[model samples]
Target: MHALFKHLRQVRDGGQRREYSRYLAQRMGPMIHALMLVGALAYLVAVIAGTLVRHSPLPLWLRLAPLPLLLLIAASTRRVRQPGLLSTLTLLCVALLEIGINLNGADDLHRQSVVLPGLLLPVASSVIWLGRWDFIAAMLLCALGPLPMLLSGNIDSALVFQYLVYMAIAIVLSTVLRAFMARTLFEQFRLERQLREQANTDGLTGLLVRNRFLELARSALAELHRQRQPACMLFVDADRFKQLNDQYGHAAGDAALVALAATLRRQTRAGDLIGRIGGEEFAMLLPGNSLEQGCRRAEQLRLSMHEIRRPDGPLTTSIGVACSQRCRDDIQTLLARADQAMRQAKNTGRDRVVCSPDDC
Candidate 1:
């Protein structure tokens, strides 16, 4: 059906609709956790089989059964949740569960209490997921899960005491390590976000740079295509910029350019893309705009630039407007049309707006 295909398209692109990916990642963690439990069962069976068969070493196939599951879990964890936290907790739980059953199967002299150390790991994880105060409460429950076995005389008295000491040490160590790791992850994520924002934005005017402009334009075009809507591109060039730079000095020229860039930002909508493409040349991409609307917007920008004449010398700007057509799928074509129109505006006279050939 059309609806089914649309849903598939949304998932396949993995853009804008990222909740599905997040959900998939979250679910995969539990699935891998289930796989770990299966691995524990398989490992138990292999140990029992080897004991009964009186084999010095378990068969390679039996030993290999859990290896694949471990690798799968390790690989899958990175794609789902925070690897530092979720994977560590999963590994700790699996280790505890494995040690618990192994201890249960050991001979009287070799038996040791491992359940306490193992159970405390999930408590640490719960603490990480919740908070430190909540974890303290959760740790009590964790201690209780292993206490029944230790108090029932199934485990040796010395082993129980040793486990209690070891559990205490593990609780302190794991909590400290996990807390440090959690802070490190949070710091890294915050730094990454800041860097991404810096990269997308211009240093001087706080507008988007040319590189980011192209990215946003492409993304907008994709959305426009989906909605069957038209968009427009406007290219603006400061008239007699070279003359102004020569007469008033480059610093004054720079100030004028920055002022113009600020004007563009103020004039455009939240959805519009405004970028300084080159020295004294800027571009704007407006979605859901027709050729006439594009012309009016370009005229408005031109008038705003004319009104804000620099103190050293009056400044003027020329604008070229191009609207997307039935055959126009690429940004370059729209830009070329706008560029041609801008050149035409420059040729005719300064401080005027020019319409694209498509508009004419």
Candidate 2:
């Protein structure tokens, strides 16, 4: 029961986890449609068989009662966007079919065998494509499908006991199978996420890698353009970084880089993008900031870097500030200008902020 509730919570929480929800919906939609179509065809064949070979005790209309529901389910599966909704509807359709068959075939012993096997279909479907609440709904409906027959005294006591035992076994098996599949799917999603992070992020600083940072900067620039807002880019290079590396070991250099990354993360807004674009250089994209605002921010960052203490001495950074309002340039061109400004700061002094010449 605890496991069942845990699975239910996972399904309920899936809306917050968009990637997993989308993947589940895409996979389950086709499975539901295919299963409904096959079920409809099999029912059609069964009706023909009953009419030609052995006269069914139930009326033809009674046996065909679930056909329209099956078709409706198939159509709905294609249109429904949420996986939880689709699974619920599919389980309901299966349950309705089970009830209809049991009620229609209550008088015949041979018909009971055929009708009872239909109960397994919902259990199997729920195991393969649904969560705990869905599975429970399917189990309840399928298990109680023969209840009307039992109440009416149509089925013998021995047959009733046997059917109940079969249902118990089916439920247990379905539960186990659902657990295994859910765990495997979760592990696969976790691994894929880790791989994506490794590809996009720097291993040392945990900032965006050079190429990924450029891609994101381009996206941010496009967004700012659409909003008719100004955006700023800051190109930051560590001052006298080679001297620090020469005096200390490479490990000290790595630690300084990591510390710089942490400082940048702390000083920037949540929406800002920070990246390690080179060995001793980093970049930041600040959306909605004009040239004047960008220069102020760059100066603040420069001061913060100077305050960062290292084993050898205090660290300092040279920052170049560029803004979208300064000129009609693409992201790459703006970044190039910012890099040139940073070089100017480097040439004049070791630690300072410089705006683009035109903007200055």
Candidate 3:
């Protein structure tokens, strides 16, 4: 039951449905086709047994009718791109074909019993693959399946009522099961997304964590190296962060850091990557930028930080700029150079930007 619900959830999830459809096309479709072929062969065997042993007068055409339908199902399964649609259509075809066969054998009590149970196949298929609307369609088709027997005057009122009760039970079960599976999948996806965000982002600042930022920076550096394009790293530090904590409190320092993070975000371009690398230290990666351009950007960030007002006073930052041309393609080497430049800014006086030694 658990395995079946998992399959249903895979088919139902909008994000995964397309891939699941392709999987159905490659794997499940062939399995279903094989099952249909086996059913067709079984029908042939049943016809032979009925003729030889029971002396049943079943028409050869009636027995052969399912073959063409089975072939159509195989063709449709192979051609359909959507799994839910394919399953719904296939189940409808199977239900209709079963109904027609049952109509042909309406006079035989044993055959009627065998064929009546086939109506549940669509309900089961719907539960396994169909979303809400498609499941409703499958249920409607299942409800209409026994209509031909009633119209033909082959089935009595009591038998009709019995079939209705059976269908009602199947519908309730399928609906409940599908709803449960959908809820389970939704919760699972939501939890996974939350966990991923928590893992990648800093808890307080809502910026990429040090490790995640480093990973992205390395990737950007590799791309820049391949393209032979220049990139820059800015290592920024709050100029008097320790003083703020000493004067006010840790809370005030934290608020100032959050504000600084927001200012950095506002100052950087869409392509630029920014993260808090340590207490009072932040890093930004500027792709396709030269040393001069990086210095200007860092100055802009430094000025922006100087404008941010706190309860104690205005906050300020020192920024160090290092270009890929001077530091090579290594992230650590580039950051180290940038860190040295940042220290130069801090030493000369706070709230300024300094370039790497080679650039200076």
Candidate 4:
């Protein structure tokens, strides 16, 4: 039940829906092209067969007139980049094909013998559509496409009723096929997104993992450099993480870590980047912060300590601030400097903030 609700939420979320649509279109693009090509060729064959076999009273030019337009729509589908647009274009091609059929059988004399071709399009379209709008539109055209030919020709009323029954069955078949395919694609989309999220984030802290953090930090640093901005990196270490585990059990240590992470999230600006670098270690990148500002922020964090609770009543962190004046340095440089200062803070006495190279 929870999974079903999650799927529904994904379906209703505008951003998620857009993502799913793009994926669906990309995965099915080649198939859509192949099927459209085949539909065009099959349509051409049916038109020619109708003209030759029934000795259609309609001129050959008139019977074949819509063929070029039908192929044009089919060709246009190759360049269709949007999700719903392809469905519309493909349906237009189906419409044109139906037009050609009606033109060939307009003469009452030929309707009886030419009826089968019109019936085929309705059933064969089970896989061609991408959504409800296109499916409904295509089904309408395919279902009634043979009507004029049957009514105008010498066919009896009972045969006409049977043709309608055939179209009903085609509608059911197309609906079931489209629904099954759509559900499968949506489930695949949901599963892939879940895997991506799990891979990119730390399981316990809900923070970006090391490699993902580095990738985003690099991109952000490049942007800041382009704009001639300053940034700071803060390397935070739990001062007695191992001792906490030894004295109070791993559960207390894990609880303290979770609280520490929550504090970092609450204290940072929206633009700042935070990551769990590894066990008992975390890093933060603050865009547009100067050396003094970074040091001030680190001091505030040391004093408050995210309210981490332990058997000894509280826990503390050692923070190192590394700053760039003009955002000229890479993430690696800032990280190295910050790590050095954090080690200094740990050596000189824990629960304090230190700036690299005695700059501040």
The lDDT of each candidate is 0.65, 0.77, 0.72, 0.79
Per-residue lDDT of candidate 1, residues 1-360 (tens digit): 233223334334444234433333354456555555555555556456545654333344544444555555545554557434554555444545444433443332333424433444553454233233445544554554465555554647776777677767766665665466445434444466579779998877777888888888988977886887888899999988888889889888888888898889789886898887888888899999988899999998888886567755567888998988555467777877888899999999878999885642
Q: TM-score per candidate, in order?
A: 0.61, 0.79, 0.61, 0.75
List, residue by residue over 1-360, the lDDT tens digit for candidate 3.
555445454445675666544543444455555655555565566556555654445566766677677667766665565666667656656665565456355545534544344455555454344345656766776677656655464446676676677778877777777777555644555566579879998988988899999999999899888888889899999987888899889999899988988898888786799888999899999998888788888877777776889876788788899998633558988888899999999999978888985552
lDDT of 1: 0.65
TM-score, candidate 2, is 0.79
Residue 296 lDDT, candidate 3, scale 0-100: 84
**lDDT (Cα, tens digit) per residue for candidate 4, span 1-360:** 234224445588788878887787778777777777887787678677766666657788777778787777778777675888877777777778777777866765634544566566766776656656677888888887777767774767887888788778778777777767777777888899889989998988888999999899999988888888878899999987888889889888888888888888988997999999979999999988888899999888887784767777777899999987653778898888999999999999988999875342
Please give the RMSD to the true structure for each candidate, in Å: 10.4, 4.2, 7.6, 4.6
Per-residue lDDT for 96-187 in model 2, tens only?
Answer: 67765564556455346443555566465654464556667777877777666664644467767777787788777777777777766666
Query: Worst lDDT window (10 residues) for model 4?
Result: 1-10
Residues forming the 10-long window of minimal summed lDDT in candidate 1: 1-10
Candidate achieving the largest lDDT: 4
By lDDT, the better pick of 2 and 3 is 2
Error of 1 at 64 (Å): 15
Question: How many Å off is the CA of 82 in candidate 4?
Answer: 3.9
**Comparison by TM-score, 2 against 4, better one:** 2
Best by the TM-score measure: 2
